[model samples]
Target: MISAEPFVSGKYLIDGNWVDAKDKTTVINPANINEVVGHVALCSEQDVQNAIESSERAYHSWKRTPLEERAECMRAAAEELKKIIEENVSLYVRENGKVLVEAKKDLLRCVDIMLQGADEIFEWSKAESLQGPQKVIVRKRPRGVAAIIMPWNSPLILTFKRVVPAILTGNTVVVKPATNCPLALMAFLHVVESHFPPGVINVVTGSGAMIGDVLCTDPRVRTVAFVGSTETGKDIIRKSASTVKKIYMELGGNDPAIILDDAILDEKAITRLRMGILKAAGQVCSAIKRIYVHESRYEEVVGKLTKEFQHIYVGNGIQPDSMMGPLNNKNQFDYVTGLIQHAKDSGANVKTVGIKLDPDTWDQGYFMLPSIVTGVNQQSEIVRAEQFGPVIPILPFKTIEEVVEMANDTEYGLRASVWTENEDLAILLADQLDAGAVFHNNHTIFQDLHLDFPGAKESGLSRETRHCGMEYFSDSYGFAN
Candidate 1:
């Protein structure tokens, strides 16, 4: 059993103070459900209100603070966060069931995000002048208090992605982390809150069902930023409609990867495919779920992928040699398992690829081997739904037009990639695919901070990163002299 003394704080960061909740909830390690990793507060409705009020009160003054000063605080917070990177990574491994390497990447990404937001403060807050107008000047102003709800899949990076930009643009924020994995993120926020003045940044932990509506529908909240399932995003939209507040949502994704006839089937290509499907155990929003390969290269590509999958090691994340870990919770494990079983019942060929490192502990935790399915119908549940687990389906297409139609048939258009040696064909296919972000000769897992990342159709409604990211937390006003 894991020791809880180091991980448990049993408190929430509100108005720059670590406040205790009336009740507490135990957090279990996903790799060993019997092991208690830590405990967090189950915040009450009154606690939510207190956080909102604190943020609202701070917004008035925070908005007027100089941009340079705000950036300085963010840099200081980043340095402070750097000091705890190793500890946070270990906590992340236990709390979220990600292997040590993946957990470390998540923590470092948070630092990068915080520093990047600091660097962009000046560019985002600069005033623009128009020559054609009558001395018109356009300046960006902070939206009042913001409510940021983060997901459990990648808590730290996603939380700071919104928090850093929101605070850097002078908007005070109240963060609500996913209930299943809140300890690591809440602890990190504790470090961050110390760098800022009281009430500038706050955290509330509890059941989202209990306090989500309260956070989004609150009259004082001017912006609601969220990253989760599509259904939840829709609910948030309806709840915020009464106040008509600005909402930025990064919802579900059923990303596709098209393998053209001329695509290389080498080690690099196989590794990209492997990482895209198995990274974070396939819980990422942009994970490659559907693959369309040219009929001629289908057999060869499958052979390569199967070999790559056979080499993955699955066990507890803290184990040095383990490559993948368990699902974040029982519900997610059950959901993904149901999808896999459904595909099997529909007459699809299912193959379990990876080796389980610890057979005795397999039943003790939410563990499943990486599954690869072939001969799956294009319209099957496995292909159409976001499994969000370590299950991927490979299908063959006769022609380019047929594959393009199959790829664009889904309602989700969050991200997609095309792999081909022909640059001209890659670009053409990318343009034709219905996704927010498309890549040529690569997978969709790679990201660039300076690019505009947004979703199309039901995938998402707003953009994040670069200018769009900062603007999402602010409003623009035009002044004439």
Candidate 2:
């Protein structure tokens, strides 16, 4: 067990004060036998009311501040955020069960998104010349008190994606990070509160069902930003609509990757595909859950992937050799395990990769071997639903048209990637793929801060990034960078 010193001295930055929650929720290190790393304060309804009122009071003057001044505040906060890089990664790995290297990557990615928001402000401020002297200065101003409800999957990046733009756009915010992964976002808000004024960025961590409802329905919040599953996003949309508030959502994704026969089954391509499906234990919404491979190369690709999966080193994240760690929490672990069992019982070909390690040691923690499923028919449950685990369910297709149709058959259209060495074939397949973002030669992890990332159908409503993120703080028509 790792020794615990107070990593973050303060908690709950409410109206600029480092206080505690009325009730606290204990955060466990899942990889370490439910060890208590720290406690997150669960805000009461009264706490939510206070935060909203504080943001509302500050918005009066904050919204009037010049865009340059707002950008300066965001930059200062970003600098503070950068300072906590090492400390934040430590907390993330301990509490969230991600490998140390992956946690560091997340922290760095968060910084990039923050800087991107600052750099893109100039483009958002461009004024257009009208036909007459009545120059239409289409200024993109802050929406108001933005209530940001971020999920546990990617807390740091999600913070920068929403909080940075909301702050740069001149909107005061109250962040309610997913209780399971509040540590990193809490550290981030601490940096903001240190440099920015009170109420500019307040964080209240708590239960989503209880505290989230208060934040979403409160009249003081002009806009609500969320990143989570589809069911919860839909609920927030319904609640926010009653208040006539702007709702920005980034929900679930059942992404697919189509491998054409022209694709080379080289060592590099096979290794990349394995990493894409298994990263973060495949807990990500954009993780490649389905793969439609051309019939000719189907066996060859599966052979390569199975061999790669067999080599994964699963253990505690603190161990340097441990490439894969336990799932973030027990709920997620149980969910993934249940899904695997369901697939097995439903007659899908399930294969467990890597040695079983020690089942005796595994009983104390939530650990499962990375899974792969093949030979499942198109109408199987595994193909239709989002497993959200480190299991890739692959199907063989004879033609490009049939494969594209198979990829688009799902209720989701979040992301899809087509792998091929032939440029023309790759482009043709990418264009026909029905996803918000399509990759020609790689998996769906090809996300940059500048890209407009969102989902389609039951996935998500509005986009998030660059102007899309800035627009989260404004009316749908008002453009903001």
Query: TM-score: which candidate is best?
Result: 1
| Candidate 2 to native Cα RMSD, angstroms | 2.7
lDDT of 1 at 391: 91
Give one digit per residue, the lDDT tens place, for model 1 in 43-138: 889899999999998998998999889989989988999999887777888989999999998888888888878888888778999777488899
TM-score of candidate 1 to 2 decimals: 0.97
| Predicted structure with the largest lDDT when compared to the true one | 1
Q: What is the C-alpha lDDT of each candidate?
A: 0.87, 0.78
Runs in model 1 deviating more than 4 A are: 1-3, 6-8
Displacement of the residue 85 alpha carbon in candidate 1, Å: 0.8
- Report the C-alpha displacement of residue 209, candidate 1, in angstroms: 1.7
Candidate 2, 1-481: lDDT as tens digits: 4556354422677788878555786887777765877878877788878888888887888877787777777677777777778866777888777888998998888777777788887787665444554544455566789998888877887777788888777789988888887876677767766777778878777778877789888888888888888899888888887789888877888899888888877888887788778778787888888888989988988888999999988877766777887788778888878877888998888999875444556766667778889879788887787877778888999987789888888888888888888888877877887677877767745466777668878777776455637776764332333
Candidate 2 at residue 376, lDDT? 90
